[model samples]
Target: MSASVDIRSVSKSFGDVHALDGVSLAIAPGETLALLGHNGAGKTTLFRILLGFIEPNSGEALIDGLKAGCRQARRLISYLPENVAFPKTLTGREVVAFYAQLKGAAASEANAALEQVGLGEAASRRCGTYSKGMRQRLGLAQAIVGNPRILLLDEPTSGLDPLSRNDFYQLIAGLAEQGTSVLLSSHGLSELEARASRVAILRQGHLVADGPLAMLQRDARLPIRIRVKTKPADAETLHREFGGRRINGASVEVTCEPDEKMAILAALHQRPGAIADIEVIPPSLDEVYRHYSRANPDKEARS
Candidate 1:
C-alpha cells in the first residue's frame, strides 16, 4: 500500500549555514507533491533529512508514523537522485537487479522494471554505452523495481527527451494511482503544474508557500490576461469601450483580477458580435512560484 510522510518543525544547519528552518509539510497516501525551490534553497537539504542522510537539529520526519532512518521506514521508501550513477561495467538489467536485491525484491522483476521504463530492449547493454537519456531511463527502472510505498524523485527528467519524459510521468501517475506517495523536486514548474496534486515552495530555507495549485493562484491574486480577437473594424471600438489596449490591429488585450474575470466576460458578451474569440490566460505555475520565492528574500545568501 501507500505511505504518509510528515515533516514537522524540521530545522537543520551546517555550522552557520542554515539549510532548513522549521519547515513543516506532509504528503498523504497516493498524493503527488511538488517541492519547488532554487539552488541552495534547502530543497536538497529537506530531501536529505527525509532520507535520513542527515539529522535535523530539531523536530522529526516520519514515514508511516515511524521515525525516518529506522529500518522499517527506510524499507518503505525509494529515491531517485538528481544525478544517477551506475557501475559502468554492469548491464542495465544487472543494475536494476542489483537495486531490486537491495530492496528485497525478486531478481526476476528486473526485466519487468526495465520494460516499464522502455529499457527492456537495451537491458543487456552495458551502462557505459548508454546515452544520457537512456541512463535516466535506467535510473527510473531501478527506482521503481521494488514497488516502494514512498517515492522521491529529484530532477527526474533532467536528461530525458520529450517522449521519455511523457513516459516517465505516465509511470509516476500509475504508481500514485496504486497508493504511492510521491515527492517530486524539479525546476520544471510547467511540467509539475499539471502533475502535482499540491505544491510547496521554499525560500531561503523557509516554507514560503504550500497549497493546491488553484488555491495558490487565488492567493497570489495575479491578473488574468484575456485576449479578445475581433474583426479589424471592431478592434478599436472594443479597445476604447473596454479600456484595454489594442494589439496586432485585430485583438484587444485586457487584464483583470481573478474575481473580476466573469464580470469582464459578461460585459464583453453583452456586445454581441463585437468579439469573435476570447483566450483567457491565468497566472502560470512559474509566476506563482516566483511570487512566493521572492516574497521574503533575506540579505544573507541561502546556502
Candidate 2:
C-alpha cells in the first residue's frame, strides 16, 4: 500500500540558510512517527512544505500520493501548531464548530471532540476565559474534529499538566490505532522514546538519523549501561570483578558494548548472593540524538 505521507528528496533554502536537505520519509496508515530536531532544525520548514504553506526548492512532498498543498491533499491532513490561538470573543464550542464546517464535518463533531479532550464542561465558555491547558485541549479538539487521514502535531503537550498530558497521548494513540497517520514534533524526547513507532531526527538541515529506537541505538554503537545494587560489603568485590565504577556504598555502575550485554548479564546472574538488584539500560533517544547531532556526516560517509 502507498504511504499516507511521503516526502521525496525534498530540499528548501532561504538565501544563505538551507532549511532542509534532501529529506525523504514515509508514514504508513496507523503509524505514529516522531520528528525530532532543535530550534531551526528545519522541522517547521518541513511541516510547512507538507501543509502546502510553501513549496520546496527541490523534490516533492505528497499526501497519500497526491501532490502536497492540493485541495484533496489538504483535505486529508490536519495540523495543530505549537501555539494555538483563537479570537477571545469566540466560545470553545464556536471555535471548534467553525473548524468542523471548514473540514466538511458535522457541527456535532465539535462537541464530541471537545468532550474527548476533556473540555466538555467549559465548551460554552469563551476561549479567552480558558487556561493554557484548556486552550491546548481546545486546539486538539479542533484538529481532531474531522478525523483527517494525516495528523500533524507540533509541541502538542506544551501547556498540559501530567494527567492531561497522559490523556492527550491516549487520544493520539487511539487516533493512530484507527488508521490515522500521525507525525508528531516535540522537544519531549523521553515521552516520544516509548510512544513513537519510528523516529526521524533532523540536524543542521540534514536527515541525520531515522529508524526505530533499537535500530538507531544499534547503528550508533552506543554502550548498554548496567547499574548493580549489592550489599555494602559486596559492592567493592563486584566493582573489582566487573570493572565498573562505584556509584555509591551499595551501587556500582558499568557499561558494555551492546553485543556484550548478554554475556555480562549471564556473569552477573552467577553471583546471586552479591547482586541485590540489576538494572540494564539501553542508549536512550536523547543520547542517540546527541550522538547524531554532533556526528560529522562527511567523516561518516568516508568511513
Best by lDDT: 2
Looking at candidate 2, the ten consecutive residues that score lowest on lDDT are: 294-303
Which pairs, if any, clash in model 1? none
Candidate 2: give the clashing pairs. none
User: How much is the lDDT of residue 226 in candidate 1?
Assistant: 94
lDDT of 2 by residue, 1-303 (tens): 789999999999999999999999999999998888888999999999999999999999999999999999989999999886899999999999999999999888899999999999999999999999999999899899988989998878877887888888899899999999999887646666367888888887888777887777778898899999997789989999999889868999999998999999999999999988999988887887777767898754332
CA-lDDT, candidates in order = 0.86, 0.88
How close to the true structure is residue 106 of candidate 1, measured as C-alpha lDDT? 92
Clashes of 1: 0
TM-score of each: 0.89, 0.90
Tens-digit lDDT string for candidate 1 (1-303): 324999999999999998899899989999999888888889889888888999999999999999988889889999889886799999999999999999999998999999999988999999999999999889888888999999988888878877888888889999999999999888747767377888888876888778887887778787899999997789988988887788899999999998899999999888877788999998887887777777645521231
Candidate 1's C-alpha runs over 4 A off are 1-3, 272-276, 296-303
User: Which residues of candidate 2, in runs, are more than 4 Å off?
Assistant: 269-275, 299-303
Q: For every candidate structure, what is the RMSD over all alpha carbons to the true structure, in angstroms?
A: 3.5, 2.4
